[model samples]
Target: MIQKKAYRFLLFLILQSCTQAQTFNKAKLDSFFVALNKNDQSMGNIAISANGVLVYQNAIGFSQINKGAKTPATIDTKYRVGSITKMFTAVMIFQLIDEGKLSFETPLARYFPQLPNASKINIREMLDHRSGLHNFTSDSLYSTYMGSLSLKLK
Candidate 1:
């Protein structure tokens, strides 16, 4: 078993090293930015990266419309990204499951025992947004505390 694993590892490394990496031109990217500016695009940002390299980023318009502050789109730009990050998290979690290190039926409470119905929820269900965790980010009272992020669908 160990020998087979080592052989597979070596083959993976060889394939990785044998591949040619792709490159892009800054001038072409700058032209796109110029067009964006020409259109007076407001409050917009874009991020592009490949193989751990930051290939493109541009933030145009105002970060704060009231104060009129400009922020250039860059990889470091805090765009919230929202569910996109969640997508990546889901992919990594799926990969773990694929490798047999994780499972779909694992209870959510295993990690967050504080949940009222942790035993009923699972990571797989959470990834699918079907864990029945109630959203509590909205309320007139607890809204200040729990907001609307309920572990179980209310």
Candidate 2:
């Protein structure tokens, strides 16, 4: 009887811990975002899910910070991914390499020979940002083009 009681207690504790871990505390998360916003440390929307269920989602700050009129950010707001794309591209390249479809030593020219100096660049060099390729976003006209595109989308 004592052994059975102990086992029951252990099972109860395990179930309690599991449920506690799965419980999403939205109020606490919201307060954290509020503090971040007050300190000018955070912007944009964030969604968190567990077990295929959305547990928390919130959007804070302006989509477009304008002195005259600011556009409030929403959950559906689209933001420029910027350098994040590079990380994602690197992950995909590595996955391809793992799948035997590509290799780190593969020359860029194999895929994009039209790119300047592609023959001299390897997949590893590109992933490491050592390909010496010009960043198009660094061009002075890039922001102008992006702003025009944003206006058209709006």
Candidate 3:
């Protein structure tokens, strides 16, 4: 009888632990939003995931700082990720390279030999930002580009 009771108690404890985890995490998210709203600085978006589950997220601020256009921000917003996305992309590229499916020094000429100077470009140079290929977005005229490129591609 004691062993059966202990088993039930253990099950109860496990359920209780799970409930408490969810409750506490929710409270933490609330506090985070409170802080984000309390700040006077330009609002920013936050991406958070736990157990690979993205629970709550929000974005607060004008889309364009100069124009004060209150563009509604969402998780789907595609702003330049800066260098962070590069690390992930580079890791995948290198993994393929290591698998012998690709090489860092592979020239563009291997795939498209028609382009002049294609042999001068290599995968390694592209990953290291030595490709010298101009970032079209870097042009001053490209400023204020807010729409996502992903959607267009899709």
Better of 1 and 3 by lDDT: 3
Which prediction has more favorable lDDT, 2 or 3? 2
Kindly report which residue pairs in candidate 2 clash with one another: none
lDDT of 3 at 70: 53
| Superposition error at 13 for model 1 (Å) | 28
Any runs in candidate 2 off by more than 4 Å, and if so which? 1-28, 49-55, 67-70, 138-140, 152-154
The TM-scores, one per candidate, come to: 0.54, 0.64, 0.55
- Give RMSD (Å) of candidate 2 vs. truth: 10.7
Please give the lDDT score for candidate 3.
0.64
By lDDT, rank the candidates, best first.
2, 3, 1
After the best TM-score superposition of candidate 2, give how far the Cα of residue 13 lies from its true spot, in angstroms.
19
- Residue by residue across 3-29, what tens digits does model 3's lDDT show? 545644753564455455754355645
Clash totals, every prediction: 18, 0, 0
